[model samples]
Target: MLKLFFRHKWGPALLILLLAALVFFYNLGDISLWDPDEPRGAVIAHEMLQRGDWIHLSYNGHPVTDNPALVKPPLYYWSIALFSALQGHVDEFSARLPSALAGITTAILVFFLGARIFGTKTGFLGGLIFISNHMLFEQARSAEIDMTLTFLITAALFLFYHCYHEHYRPGWLYPAYAALGLAVLAKGPVGVIVPLMIAFLYLLARRDLKAIGKIKLPAGLLIILAVASPWFILEGRAFGAEFFFRQNFERFFHAFDHIQPWYYYFVKLPIHFLPWTLLLPAAVAYWFRRRKEKNPGRTFLLIWFIATFVFFSLSQSKRSLYIVPLYPALSLLVAEALERISSEQNLASLLPWIRGGAAFFALLLVTAGGTAAWLAATRFHDLARPVALLVAAALAGAALLYRMIRKGEGRGIVTAFLVCAFGLELLMAGVVYPSIDVKSRSS
Candidate 1:
């Protein structure tokens, strides 16, 4: 039993269990809606439940006046509203459950895609890193559109890769296109724009423009139009010209509400990626070193990462979560780098460097855990000290798991699985649940 549980194929199943446990733990307390965004998103879904007015989104018994009509699609809210209908009230669990599920699904898809593109070890490592990411973990517990957009956009990229490289079936591209369309509904044009930019640049770089001709663009367009048209049509009918001008066009060219300089994402990327950002230089170095290789998968992933970065960097408005879709591509590249480090005889000398990087990350995790404990003790002194201690212990445990990876003494499969599960369980049971309780009471 122990042997079978440690097998490579078991990694994904373990990841699923870890995600489920996290979601369950995060929602154990009385449902709490945090401030502006989460509660606003929840209330919109709640309104959808009460009024049955899916087309016109409202908040606190008033029509939503802030953004353009259909600027943010109704798909996420609709999912939450549907779940709320089943439960009778839109609680934190019901509100953020879809994002949590999507986050897990994204990890699973990354595993499959990585394994298909590289190898099982690479896939496992990539998936582990993805699930362990702080941004993804935080997003999973929040009622935000970014997580949903990440899932859809990643799924679209997966489909696009398969359809372009392996399947070559016209039918397969529909899902890719539909996923993009749904992504647009989830966020906006950035969803469709990012993928298209990546695909185009990838083909261009590979001089595979001829392959683009094989894509049956008419069918893809029809599929996209079908999936994306309903909301636009509804919003147009409901809000008239304002929907088209403000939501459709203005947000892109001009900043409507929260606008920042174009360089905002450049500065934000490092902080958003956190410890993982440290590895990006290594990943990019490996990418350039292998650019001459005729591997389609590597080329595709490289283009995906570059195109996503360029696309977001050029945009007038910027948010950290906007780059979530690029994570899979970046992770795949990092996995490729790690694989080269593990396999190349000459590169074996870099093992110390790899271990050193892991140690650095572990130190960061420990520091963060200590800081969290300090904050909890100082601010929430009313709460039991054991809670903060437990949270700290969990974070330390995650760091220790990374330490084991640095030692390179255990089975890669087992280490990866345990690390992922431990990280997920720790976040869900320790940080997430307690944070929810703290935020709830404070609110």
Candidate 2:
């Protein structure tokens, strides 16, 4: 039994899932729903349930049908309402449970997508990277629409890749379109916009505008309209078509709120990517080296990243969660690159890249742990132990990973980095989270 558990094809995926569950679900409801978004989302659903009118939602007894501003779409609240109804309450656990479940399912889907397209190793790494990511950890545990929206977007992309790119199965596009339709319901227009951007640009990059002709457009549209139109019809009459405009167009150009500079996402992306962000250089180097190849999979991932980045950059209303849709693409790109580092045999080809990754990861962990130390020593003096211990772990990880890299042990270096990521999480759980709780309560 133990051997099967360890040696199964999905062994790594299952293990990473366990870790992800621990990270995302262990104390999901222990912390109160964060004000504004979390609580607001919860109330919208709970109120809808009480009124037995799922189509229209209200908050604090006022209509929240405006979209992208005072109100959000009903899909997320509907989901929360269903989960809360099942669990017999609208408390924290039931409210946040759906997002956490979606997060886990998304991670699993990442594994499946990677394994199908790249290899099992890439799948395992991709799943691990997706779950261990800085933003996924936070978003998964929170009762917010962004994570659920991310799941739908990612599912659509994966289905598209499977049906259009790999298998030539037209049936897959139906589900893919359905996923996009659901994504549109989950958020607003951005859901459909993201898929269109990725699918169109990827085909355009291949210089085949007619490639879209192969998709089941009529059937796909039917699926989309069937799944998505009902809510819009109801909500449009309840609110107005202007709500849709505000959710989509206004957010793009006007920046009524969530205003940030054009470069805001550029600065914030790497931080959300966290530990794996250290591997971006290696990923880029691989992309350059393989640029001559005609690999459609790699081309698709690159297009996914580039198109999403450019699209979000154009939007005047920017928030860190806006990039959640892009994380799966980032995961696949980094996983494919990391798999190369693990498997490549050419020292000269691999040395410079590995050296950069190793050095960056070591320095990153040390700097993060050191920053925690400084904060705990001075500003956060009461939370010194976890931060200081994290510093020690970071130093230890640096020494070990650097040594492994020098020895040409690519896998060992990755393992050491994973260890350090866990160390950081531990410190956050021990020191940072408690500090936040106390501060929240006092305030």
Candidate 3:
């Protein structure tokens, strides 16, 4: 079994493991929904189900009239509502199931796009990085529209990348635009605006204005209207003209959520890309350095990443998950960097700092695991020694893998990344979830 698994292509097997892990962790906890946002979102869907008034969102048996027009579109909430109606009551699993599934599906789409645009190795690395992201996992297990919006926007991005690379088929641009329209429904105008801005900039950068013209704008616009118009029309009829103008247009301009400086995203970027953050500068430099090589795929992805960063940076409201769509691009860039470094005979001399940095992180993980076990034993005696032993074993395994890679293992650095991420995910799903469950029950 082990030989067969190892013989199979690593990408598909890794993806299957990721999906299975996500599904398992997703089902581990009890039905206690997280507070302030997740449960609130679920309740909105539940109220919608009860009242049958999709346009006006209600909370706690009263009309939530504070800033009508549905606040956010109803894609995620509607999905939860449908699921809850079937199940008789919305639980944590039911509310969060859609986002979890969407997250996994998004990873699959990234794999396909990455493979087509770059190579199979790049795709595998990209998918592993995305699924291993702590923020992505957290959002997947919570009831939020952000993950759904990210999924739609990413789908649109995948289609758009293909459309640009392979001559724009009339059929391709339509679905691409249609996905963007659904993104709008999932979040707001940022969906349509972000992709359009990125594509325009990408074409302009490539000096491919003629290719842009082949998009069949009229048909694409109609597709967008077809997918996105009904909700806007219904909401406008239910509310007033202010629904469109204030909620859609003015909100962007006036900083409706909370205004932050232009440098807000700059501050948050490191935390958003934790563990992988150290390698981003090298990745970005590698991307621009290779641009003159006329690599359309890398160029397009870089443009997508930069455009999204700039767009959200300038937005009045900002959040970490807003940048989730950009991670795939970053992952690709990182993978490219790793591949380039690996190919060079003097790789050890060139990237001594990176190698040391990775070793440090691996050591840190081991230290943190030991510290956590000590705390559990001393402060929280309720935790079983068996669980602590499992966690320690996993951490030790990760550290050993890191050491082996440092010593020039048979597998490459990409494999090291895969093993580390896979170990961390297993630790979370296996050891951490059980710990959380025990604490919840005792409380």
Judged by lDDT, which candidate is best? 2
**lDDT per model, in order?**
0.71, 0.79, 0.69
Question: Across residues 45-102, which tens digit of lDDT does each residue of candidate 1 receive?
Answer: 9988889889878877776654443236778999899878898898877888788778
For candidate 2, report its TM-score.
0.91
The clash number for model 2 is 0
- Per-residue lDDT of 1-443 in model 2, one digit per residue for the tens? 74455345578677767877777777677677877788888888888888899887788777776443555667888889998899777988888888888899899888888787787778777888888778888888888889999899888888888877664788788888898888878877788888878988887888978877888777777887789888788766645465667666877989788889999988899888888887788777787877797878878888888888889999998989888888887898888887786777752476567667778888777787778788887786666665667778788888888888788766777767677666566556555676677678876
Q: What global local distance difference test value does model 3 have?
A: 0.69
Q: Write candidate 3's Cα lDDT for 1-443 as tens digits.
A: 63454344554646555664555355534546756578777888888888888766677876544545345677788888887889888777778877877777777777777778766666666776677656666676668787787788788778877776676766777778888888877877777888788788888988888866787777777888888888777765543345556665675567676567888878877665655665555555555556568777777878888889987786676667778777767766676666665555544443554555466657667776777777777787766564576557658755675875567632354466556665666666566766776678668
Residue 122 of model 3 has an lDDT of: 62
Number of the top TM-score candidate: 2
TM-score of 1: 0.85
User: Model 1: residues >4 Å from true position, as ranges?
Assistant: 1-25, 28-31, 65-71, 237-244, 369-380, 383-443
Cα RMSD for predicted model 2: 2.7
